[model samples]
Target chain A: MKDVSRLKSVLEKGGFAVTSECGPPKGADPQAVLRKTELLRGKVDSVNVTDNQTAIVRMSSLAACCLIKKAGLDPVLQMVVRDRNRIALQSDILGASAIGIRNVLCLSGDHQSFGNQPDAVGVFDLDSIQFVQAVRNMRDQGIIVGGEPLSHPPDMFTGAAANPFADPMDFRVVRLAKKINAGADFIQTQCIYNMERFDRWLGIARDRGLTEKAYILGGVTPLKSAGMARYMKTRVSGMDVPDQLIRRMEGVSKDKQREEGISICVETIERLKQTPGIRGVHIMAIEWEEAVGEIAERAGLLPRPVIDDQ
Target chain B: MITAQQKPIDEIRGMLVPYKRILVLGCASCVAECAAGGQKETAMLASTLRMKAKMNNEDVIIQEHTLDRQCVKDFVVTLDDIIGSYDAVLSLGCGAGVQAVAEMFSEIPVIPGLNTEFIGETRAQGLWVENCLGCGDCMLYYFGGVCPLARCSKQLFNGPCGGSVGGKCEINPDVDCAWQKIIDRLSRFGALDRLETIYPPKNWSRKQGGGPRKIIREDQQR
Candidate 1:
């Protein structure tokens, strides 16, 4: 229950934490990550390094986290069950903790069909919720998944992804509750574009007292163009992009759409600040890292709290 | 039941190139039910092979026979009287049936004319969808009689992943998301609370994870 990560400490200290994503380069280039870290260095409390986002092969999240940590930034190592089995997952957790990465995000990643390697075998040996429990068991009980005692257990803050817009709308909150019950210390949701639906899901979550169990971070992504909004609205599964938002983006002049998108993102973050049980905003400016600093500053989330890691 | 599809005529023809006299064998059970290797299909395949060989100026002769169930030794023994006259057996049965036929007549070359697909249910006319993986364990009761291991693309036991959209899986628009079906079925039964408990990682060793599996049912043994 102790705060083992700077992101955890910041939330525990009652500070509105700001986090952003850093997608590792496709090839094995560390400089690409260094460049993103340079843009994100002091603006956010912690950075979440994705594990083969969209199932496209990329630099391992652990290696990327090491690079980010070396660059004087806290890194949340995103671990997905889509690629590795339970043994590899547990092994990586030990490896990550031994190397000083303190935060881990459990995800049942995007289906392989959505990625570059559509034929790749998706190793869902453990779902995201079960993965959260595995990490918790490894950290708290000082044991591996099969019940053997580890020499030194990983003391890391575990997180899981929640998709508020996924189908079977009535069961979304139930799934979120399951994640928390499985020992997810924190949650980062899928990108939110429809505030009405997001607010409705959050209301049900609040009613069930799920908000008090774990730290919830509202996910916000700044659309780069009107076309991207349309693609996300029509093509992206589990994403609920409102048509009105797409119209708003399309209504603006071509040159001003990016600015309009940023304005909308900043407004979403500001609104999230007032929402009950929302401890922070996770800005996923995909390939648009520069926009995160501007979004954070515009939403008055600058000067992120620097908590000394224990 | 176990479902299968007939291998392409070209592939079956290629396998029969060395033989002049062959038996076009079919199973009257699961494969017959799926319309892959039934008596009617066996006769048609025999006629086509004979005509194709004649057209190509090859002296090949084919005889067709459909067994009650090729997987059973009792039915397989019915072919024993005429087995010695044929050079090989082109079995239109499933993988298990073909193997069983091969085992019964140790001397005859058995070429499979069909590829075993999966344990499936006949959804409609000419449509067979896979419904079971034969994971060696069944937990259908927990899932409202729907098997997530067999139907889910990821075989996820806990719940649906984010890829489930509007009841269709993201992998292919044609395939219904198994988890969506499970949720709806459970909801209709008012048993949605069953999903509240987190199921642990499956013991995959019961599956092919432990290598080629076998069940020695001692009670059925003489």
Candidate 2:
């Protein structure tokens, strides 16, 4: 609560924050993280370091966050309960804070079955909501999950994930409220392709007054090709890519698809900015981090607002 | 009831490599109901082991026996007379039943032939599906009798985790999403509002976290 990061400060200052993600390399290569952070530097408010995203084995999120920090960019440490028990999670939170990382994103994580190591054992000791509560307690109450008093509790700006496209759609906002109540200061949602549906979700969220509780950042992933659009539509679960979007990508020439994708992303960002409850956008360009600057510039998110405090 | 399934024949055979005489023990209660470990199953396993031993030209004596319930002391005592003749006892019961037999006869090695699955009910003539996790804390009342801990692959109390598509789980299309079922049941009972409130993380001390749990009723002791 005390050591608010730049992302939290921007949101507090009523600035429309633009956050991007940097995926850690599969091996223990610090340069990979530095490279991605360098690309994301000065273009966005913060960079989210994914925690072995999609359950694949990669550099630990904490290590990557530290590396990103060394690269002179604010790193949002994405922590998933899928890989660690409460002990490890609390310990890592303290370690991350000790290393000057201020932002943390709580998630249940993609199940290990979806990863390369499908046979690996998952430790879902705490769900996303529970994780947020635990982090809040550590930051505010100076206590560990087991009620042990910590001499120096982590001062982190806690965040959680939300998927508007997930099934039992009516309950998505309700779940978001739960995260907010559990002490999520901000929420980065699942990738958005269907703007109309996202608008409807935001309407419900606004009606429920959830936007007041937490900073809502709409998730945007620029499609790379028509094949990527089709794959996202048919293969990915919990993604709501409309038929028209896929058709639009398909209609484009093979060479122009990437440009079309960027336009779509820019348009999505512009529309999301107009949405009632959305305060910012989290652009997940995946491995294509180099294009983030152009996309943000095109979406008019560039000339990033400079917060006075470091 | 606790259900189980037999391990592969090759693995079971490998376990009996050093033993000359073996007893294929079966639990006639839960395992029998699920057609996993029963009197008939014990006989078949004993015959298979004997055939394999003969094919290998190994001198081994195979015996078959089925107890009413291996978890009960009275039923475990039935093996006392003939147990001395066997070098090893291959138990076809749940994990608890196997331990019970091990506790009763400390000298002989107790190898588990069947892998204990879960506390479940027979869904069909031959199919058994998990119904309970014995998490020590039950939330069935809130979930309309469907235990999410047992049904949800993630054991999520506030799920179906975004992977729930249509009505099935993302891990496997055949598995029904526990939350979806809970919602439907709650809606039917005019209690869909129950799901509106978020459930906090489960108190895991009541689960295996507190270590081996026990229940002692002083009133029923005497």
Q: All models: lDDT?
A: 0.91, 0.89
Instruction: Estimate, for each residue in B153-199, the C-alpha lDDT of model 1 and write its tens digit.
Output: 87788878777889988778898889999999998999999999998
Per-residue lDDT of candidate 1, residues A15-68 (tens digit): 888889999999998999999999997799899999999899999999999999
TM-score of predicted structure 1: 0.94
Interface RMSD of each: 1.2, 1.4
Worst 10 residues of 1 chain B by lDDT: B154-163
Q: What is the model-wide C-alpha lDDT for candidate 1?
A: 0.91
The lDDT leader among the candidates is 1
User: Model 2 segments beyond 4 Å from truth?
Assistant: A1-4, A146-148
Q: RMSD (Cα, Å) of candidate 2?
A: 2.0
For residues A133-155, write the lDDT of model 2, one tens digit per residue. Answer: 99999999999877889999898
Q: Candidate 1: misplaced stretches above 4 Å? A: A1-4, B17-20
